[model samples]
Target: MDSIQRKKLVNELISLIEKGNAHVSFKESVTGLPSELRTIIPENLPYSIWQLVEHIRIAQKDIVDFSSSAGSESLAWPDDYWVEPTDTVTDEDWNNSLQQIEKDQQRFQALLEDEQHDLFAPLPWGTGQSLLREAMLIADHNAYHTAEIVVARRLLKSWK
Candidate 1:
């Protein structure tokens, strides 16, 4: 793609990451949830809303870190990605996790916006990995889990 086209596409990807598409945006899905209800696991869901938030926070950080490096090592599956099941989430943990998510998201955006890196170029340490693919993965992963949180909240009547 030409420079103009690349710029537009990058901006669009960032926008989709932020606002979502044809579904509830992450901001709308996650915000306004009662802190007290964050740890309540409704029927059928394996993870509480706080657990979901923490999972996203952990996974997103891993992805962002991976994207910036040439290393191909994956985080320990299901272990590093999730926290221990808990009945309560402290205000500090909850707030810190969300803030980390926001900060990492901005870093991802900056990675895309950086003129020095080529989004489509394959990383040397990987079989075939690129920033473009990683960005989409993070966005899709977050959106899916954010929706899960929304559903759990709805089931628990914590989100209206």
Candidate 2:
């Protein structure tokens, strides 16, 4: 692909992951959540805001790690991606998880922007997954859970 096309694709992928064009961005969904409500599981929901945030961080970090390195280790599905039901999130834990999410997302964006990486070419270490596919997966997965955070906030009467 030409430089111009690569630049455009990078921009679009970044926007999809970072912006709230059609739905709430991850930052928008998590910001200003009350401390008390972060751990409160809304009725019928499987996760709280804190749990969702941690899950997003873990999953996104895994994807970024896997996409950027051939020797990257995969986390166990479901269990490794989510916080335990009985776990408690302190202020430090919450802040750390949020910060890591932002940092790792920036890492993923850098990988996308780097000219050395081929967005469409499959990683030799994986089955048939490419950087492009992983980018879309990150965007989709984060968006899905971010929406859940918003809904949980709404259910708790915390969202604006």
lDDT of 1 by residue, 123-152 (tens): 666668888998899889989998998899
Model 2 whole-model lDDT (C-alpha atoms): 0.91
Cα lDDT tens digits, model 2, 84-122, are 754466889888999999999999999999999999999
Sequence-dependent TM-score of model 1 = 0.94
Candidate 2: minimum summed lDDT over ten consecutive residues — where? 84-93
Error of 2 at 90 (Å): 2.0
Predict model 1's lDDT versus the native: 0.86
lDDT of 2 at 58: 94
Q: Candidate 1 — number of clashing residue pairs?
A: 0
Candidate models: Cα lDDT each: 0.86, 0.91
- Quote each prediction's TM-score: 0.94, 0.96
Displacement of residue 7 (Cα, Å) in model 1 is 0.9
- Residue 75, model 2: lDDT of 93
The runs of at least 3 residues in candidate 2 whose Cα sits more than 4 Å from the true structure, single-residue gaps closed, are 86-88
